[model samples]
Target: MKRFFLLVLCIFATSCTGGGSCAGKKEVAALPDTFIWNLYSDPKSIDPGLVQENSGSDVGVQLFEGLTEYHPETNEPVPALATSSDVSSDGLLYTFHLRQDAKWSNGDPVTAHDFEYSWKRALDPKTGSYYASYFYIIKGGQEFNEGKNTDGNSVMVKALDDVTLQVTLKHPAHYFPQMIAYPAYRPVHRKTVETFGDKWTHPEHIVSNGPYKLVSWEVQKEMVAEKNPYYWDAQNVRINRIRFLLIEERETALKKHLEGSAHYTDDIPTLKIPTLKSNPHYHDAIQLATYYYSINTKKKPFDDVRVRQALAMSIEREKITNVLQQGYPTRNLVPPGIPGYTTAKGLSFNPEKARQLLSEAGFQDPKTLKVTLSYNTNENHKLIAEMVQNMWKENLGVEAELYNQEWKSHLKNVEEGNYEVGRFTWIGDYVDPLTFLEITTTASTQNYSKWSNPVYDDLVLVQSGKERDPKKRFELLQQAEEMMLEQAPLIPLYHYGRPLLLDPRVKGFYGNLQDMHPVKFAWFEEEK
Candidate 1:
């Protein structure tokens, strides 16, 4: 992170020589072979099958091996446990040739059977995995997860031999390989799991197949991982250890980074973005993620589209972006310029129109309607909520009470529809626009909004299946996005940018659109 920061400072300095903001930066020191990173919240779960959040995923990737992985720099799907693949002409059948050399941290052979067990375990109704929907593209996957079939054999995932796996898909998805890199699809050590039961992922019992193994975990303080000596390709791994510290406040994270104890952080205090903007150590990537608030369409007031629209438009999104000084201004559910698809625009800010909509929704003066805006206990989230709270009051005369809860509780409340509206963000697991559009589908477990429309549902869930041409499929997807925007189940605020503190010596760590970088590829360059 510090290394990346210094590079940025030099680049920015060259462009801003007249102002010379970065003229006097000192040389950065090479970090020891240990990378220290920060997480906004402690991971909710580290279990490969159960972990749903990104913090868990960051650790999951280091401690588990998947059939494929995203290239560190290009973000392209490449073989990992699998050495090669062959697809049937229809693109529905994928035959993976697994690497014979792969082994778990326990020295047990990593076989095609491991992946078969893991994928089926994910699809099993008994697992209650929220992310099981990610594999719904595989034939019979949805039926298996939904309990329509008790037979795991009915699902099209099969291990043909010790080192060969086959997957039959319901449709030909161009992005399925990329999606496979997600931690939920990674193999688990079945014997360890059977022995430990639900405690299989404990630091002591977990037998991972990735480049790192869990060394220690101090709970809310930090979790440490060290290089696996037995890793199949251990020689290529540079950093020997990684520490993921859980610190909610970006200010504290920045202090840790500036003091040289921390190598990277997910976010810095927004106020610091300007000062560090020209600093070489600061980094921000426009991630494939959207920052929005979920409106519980099952709840009153929000059950009305006008009410949702009015609330969405009343808040000025630009003001929020200006304050953060990160990300592009967007009224889009799918962030604009996502490669192939046309960006769908949502309701724009017009205070008068917001007032008219509120009136139409039977709140002649919205102050009579009291709503609670719930968010996680992060300072940035609090400040943004307060700004929107004032906007609701000043623009539409609504009384919005601000509520903050810890990350885990906040997500649970949103899932249970315990709040009328709550803060949420969706980072695309893959580059596909479908990653964003599919989440709000009628049947998706991740659809916290509880907003369902037959037309929108069919565009995503049904029509999407029949469209074989890439352009036609995207067209169907755009139709779905348009319907979703019209209904306004959530407020489209702005796209995300990972405003991070990076050590200058940290090398080979790449941030893709999804903003995921495997720690195995990271190294500290020799400082001159």
Candidate 2:
């Protein structure tokens, strides 16, 4: 799953001369053969192994090709680095045949050995990858990541030859192919990483196997990439270059889009939704994502289950969703519409019960239970935090201080357990109930709540993967979600919708559940 707050930036201009066409405004001319996107923020990390958020994955997908890639229209896994693959009858062994034509941007041949090294490096504990658990399905992956296994060779991933990669799984995973399409499974140029160390991802030093290669990155300002001629299918890659403008304000981003500076942008101001609902360029789709408040369970007051439950029960989710004019209000962690799975409901708004629960937890006055609510910088997040802050004060008589930080710093604060309650969002990496459920497991680095239970670990980490029967496996997952909800380590707010603005000239971008638009498949329409 992807972590990080969703938002965008733009500077507002006062006058539009010709109706709504922004006439007389000196429009930023669209560059021929280039696709300019308003990438919400500067990606925290472009390194696939360390990226845990959409900002990073969005750019990473353009620069690195995994064994499989998501289909433009369907999001189904399709061959990329690997031309084809075979699975053993037992479903535990996977053999991927690498594409002989594939080569890194630096002209080095892309081989199966790169995949083997990349997977092992991701699983290395020193790497501190939040997504390392994703490899646990591979045999010996968990042991190696947990430091229980010292030998890297013990992991089941291996390069049988220059073109063949073999992987042995601990159990059958029906979605293994789809899982490999995620950024965490993308291969890195082993030599580049070893030589440059932390600077390997710099624009000049990076060597990639995807359709595009980084040419420049101006930190919070912008990043530019040019098409990679060494890429296996480079001829079919229509866009010659991509400019990702790091815009942080929705109003400013909208203004830029209106001024013809951007071809595609997913950030829209909440207040402007009604006016833009019927605009030809406006697009909205339900995404496989959840926005919630993660409680620091190890911290005081939140350490009590009663306190956590009370906090959850006091949220007026319906009001928040209604105000934002976005998102489907939800109490369940897993969003609906996943095949073969049903969502389990959790705590609902009950001000009286919340007050009683606070009293029962030894905080009778409620006013004495003061806490801080932290969130990343964004207009919507700020508004939501204020709304929740008021709800807690009015319902439970609890006072909360609202703290905001930039996207990168906010993620660090949450990971370091620096807040009593923090705003968090998770966009599914792949379409599956487990993608959402597994993040809360005790050993999960994404578990910012710092809450754990043996039953949850057993159900999600151990039993769910091993259960071969689809129906039985889903039941175990549902049960695990219900158990976690009962403890209230997090308050599920809503399943958000991805609101986007696209120029009519943009083509090949399709709406999908995961909200992923691989730039390799997108192109600008020829001018008539």
Best by TM-score: 2
**Off by more than 4 A, model 2:** 1-31, 526-528
What RMSD does each model have against the real structure? 5.7, 6.2
Clashing pairs in 2: 8-248, 8-249, 9-247, 9-248, 9-249, 9-253, 10-249, 10-252, 10-253, 11-252
TM-score of each: 0.93, 0.94
For model 1 the TM-score comes to 0.93
Clashes of 1: 13
Predicted candidate 1 versus true structure: per-residue lDDT over 1-528, tens digit per residue: 011001110111111112211233433223477888887577888888999888998899899879887666666667788777788877788888888889899899999999999999988988888798898999999999988999999999999999999999998777887889888889998899889989888888889999999988887788989998878889978888888887777788777777666777767787888898776666667788899988999989789999998888888999999987887777888987667789876788988998898899888867788899999988789989999999998898899999889988898888888999899889888887888888898878889999888888888877887688878888888888887988889887889888776666667675557877788766776444
Lowest summed lDDT across 10 adjacent residues in model 1 is found at: 1-10
Q: How far is 57's C-alpha from truth in model 1 (Å)? A: 0.9
lDDT of 2 by residue, 90-125 (tens): 788888888899999999999999999999999999
Q: How does model 2 score by TM-score?
A: 0.94
